[model samples]
Target: MSFRAPHDGELLKSEYALRGFLPKADPLTAFPCGSPYAPLDEIGRDLPSLLYDKGFRSYARGLRLPPWQTRVSVETLPLLRLYYVRIGFLASAYVNQVGEEPVETLPGNIAAPLIDVAQRLRRPPILSYDGYALYNWKRFRKDGPIALGNIDTIQNFVHMYDERWFILVHVEIESIAAEILAAIANVKRKLAQDANADLNRELWRIEGAVRRQVETLKRIPEHMDPKLYYKTFRPYIRFFDGVAYEGADTAPMQFRGETGAQSSIMPMLVAFMKIAHRRSILTDHLDDMRAYMPAEHRTLIKEVAALPDIGAPAYREVFNAILDAMASFRRVHYGWAEDYINRRTDDPRGTGGTPYMRWLQQLLTETEARRL
Candidate 1:
């Protein structure tokens, strides 16, 4: 089903429900004027940065405060370390393919082999929503962290693949993929458990809980808008950057810095195409493998091979179109950059007066150009 924006009343109702109290009568309304349910400054630090507390005198002052540090468990730490390694390897592969200088910290040349190993070690596991289970349940949750404070509106999941299909891949890949996810999840879960135990045992639980409540109070009352959520959350979305590339004689090598939507959209487009090709090859091989089988099994194998090439063609076409669009978009945006600088004394956002907004405008221009 297509997404529909919530009405203001719906947003307000959701916020009220999530907070576990009526809006006006809630203890959060008391603030500094009365004995607050929790301390204001302490709570401000615990709340998500996107939210603002109505009671807080200065958002800047709140921002300047030190953030709470949660203890990381050894089990969880290793998983995080592995995640970093995976990211490094992926980055390296991209860079190597692009024929560029590899960054020292990232695993520049080992990405493909590492990912292959990961794929081999995979297993299919049931998706769980347990907070203590780890692996970022927030990613799978219907309402994400954005809904924590405001409660009125929830952000939709914005993963590149369809969740159901992606889950199916895990099932198809089975054991290896499942094991990888469980390993990661287990680590995160243990870490959170350890942290929580430490907080409780050390008599810090009261302080932490109070601080969290206070911060919750301070956050902006507005429901999260999807566009705003995307803009704010874009940076945190993982993209492997700064891997070295080995030169290739045949393939075109293009290197460009990407941020915002392009950073994610580009890599996803590339990965989707690569996966499509792999699936096609696998399907073909499965067909060949069937030829050696008994007549009954052979028929079954052919049937499997004949299953529609679901995403391969569509993803390939979409990616190519995006690339074509990007080329024209880059040219026009660069043109605007030149024009804007010529008219202005100082470059705002240090982008020569044409930031992402100009680039996006150019993308629209390219789309129109394509229509012509």
Candidate 2:
């Protein structure tokens, strides 16, 4: 299937449905008023540059709450709202100032509402130890002297939040997807193992469809330049910053965190491939193994258990296929990197900042070598 934009509401609903957690789809009569929660734009605006670069906006998109669960998410919404606010405030404060300051003191008054909202929502407040703060803050502070003056504060904020938030969001979404996929797969396995062959066929069909959707998601585009967006709002789009002193032959390059909701899908892709492979191998020989299998079969089961974690040969082939699919999907959907390289004169300094550039380069190089 061609890549198309995902409906966030629908995605969330599917997620909840798959998990058997269908939430009430009641209309939110009125959104809570005068709450400490900040507007989405405000949170976006206030995010640190480094964090922004890593693709917090993309991460939010990946959050795609099901429409039916919006009311249910109300409990977590305030917390979600506050979490971004704290990120925004910290981004604004730290960006405007050049030095490292305590997270508690950085935002001063603005932080009050954020803290209050977090408490009310039971969401943890953004802190120095959180992945966002730990990875990028020190580097941002160290590089304070040379960043672009107009966007220094924003850059630092985006970078700091990008890595920490990307990891957190990626892990959560992938974990949820993996659980649902595994459950569906398990049901199919049990049905196949049973004497009721008709029921097994029905379950297998449902499992197949779910598997296709999961594969479709792996091909979805998650990375894009924010500048290409139609809206006036521009959050951090670049995943890195390049600094070239007047006489230096090569610019210093720093990796910012990923951007966009789809970027978080990578871990899910990896997990799904692992699960799918194990399921395939297990179900393929399950009937045979049940009757005359030796004690060595126990070792095989143990080996399969370790595949997803340690990436055994079977899992490796499955993962490679998935990666190949992703690469082909990207090239077909977004055009090859040769176009980009030609346009940018193969300048790493400029293209390196783009999240998609690295992947594009890799794909193009592989394609070229094969032709040669």
Candidate 3:
């Protein structure tokens, strides 16, 4: 098998080619510029300014209710909004690539000029939601969403091939997760004002969304054949090494450590599961791990930590939903790791090969079997 290195033009095309996905511009109507949210390509250039604009600030502050609402909203909601756009762009590329009757590299005519701006700024693109703050930026937004667009999809297919399959899964979970957080915050404010407020209705809304997103995973096994993921996409993931070519190179190096979404996202989900059990497990490696999560997410974890234990039924529904999502994510990666990473690779650490992957599968399997 042969792989071509990522070229600059391909990167830009993947991120900015939004014309078809976006509605055509109509200049005569009110707000005739078209939906601000449409033509998602422009967001890479526009989102940072929008976040700092005074009007956006006012819109963010307007969401704060009950005066006692956690200040986390100032950062969390807006950042999550930004993530929705990124996920949509990545998903569009992924669905179009894989869903094509004949799967092929995005044709050259369609793949150039994709958004590779982050590499020019000397930072990785903010593809996964967890580590946006770490990237180099032209203008800082202070725990706000990074303005980088991830054109990794435009690179050699390996960088994201199978991972894209799971990322759409992750994106859905995070997308709906933003809604769940909003509902929970709303319920908290309502309860603060009136102790007898019917929070069940609000909580049930979150539970239903979570359950539905989890069910969406049933489609994964159909699109992602294990052999395909192992042979095609799995080889593209990198651990460390920051090559200078960056976007033009498929295996650009990393400065920190490995940050495959599979691992980075686990700690956040685990934090929620721990909250359901009324256990706090911060101040260690777990705390270090969560630092990659957005400030809003970190703040929400702290807020959940503060709630008094109301017994299982009080939060059981949401807890189960989160747990189900976490377990399902683990299940897919576990299968991938076992089938590929653990199969024939020799141990570089000298203990054994892929021990952590085996341990993770065992742990997740055991956790999923537990009753709430």
Top candidate (TM-score): 3
- Per-residue C-alpha lDDT of model 2 across residues 1-372, encoded as one tens digit per residue: 111121122222344334321112211212246434334334444444424243433343333221112332556643343343344334333322223221213222343433444344343222221222111211134423211121111113333432233223322333233334344344334433542323233223433433443444343234322222211112222222332212223344233322321222322333333333223322332222222211222222332233223223433443344445444544543442333233444444221134345544443344333210
Candidate 1 vs candidate 3: the TM-score winner is 3
What overall lDDT, based on C-alpha atoms, would model 3 receive against the true structure? 0.37
Q: RMSD in angstroms, candidate 2?
A: 17.3
For model 3 the TM-score comes to 0.46
Candidate 3 lDDT over 1-372, as tens digits, reads 111122122112221122111111211111114533333434333433443343532332232111111223433433323333343233223222232221123222112222232222223332323322122111223333211222111112333345455444443344344445555455455655665555666656655655654565444564466676644443322222332222343543332222333222344334434532222321232344344344434554555444333225655665566566667656755665565556746642101112446455455765576437
Cα lDDT, model 2, residue 174? 32
TM-score: the better of candidates 1 and 2:
2
For the record, the alpha-carbon RMSD of candidate 3 to the native fold, in angstroms, is 17.7
Please, what are the lDDT tens digits per residue for candidate 1 over residues 90-206? 232323222223332322133333333233223101011100011121223434432332221111122222222222221222111222222222322333344221111211222
lDDT of prediction 2: 0.32
RMSD of each: 22.3, 17.3, 17.7
lDDT of each: 0.27, 0.32, 0.37
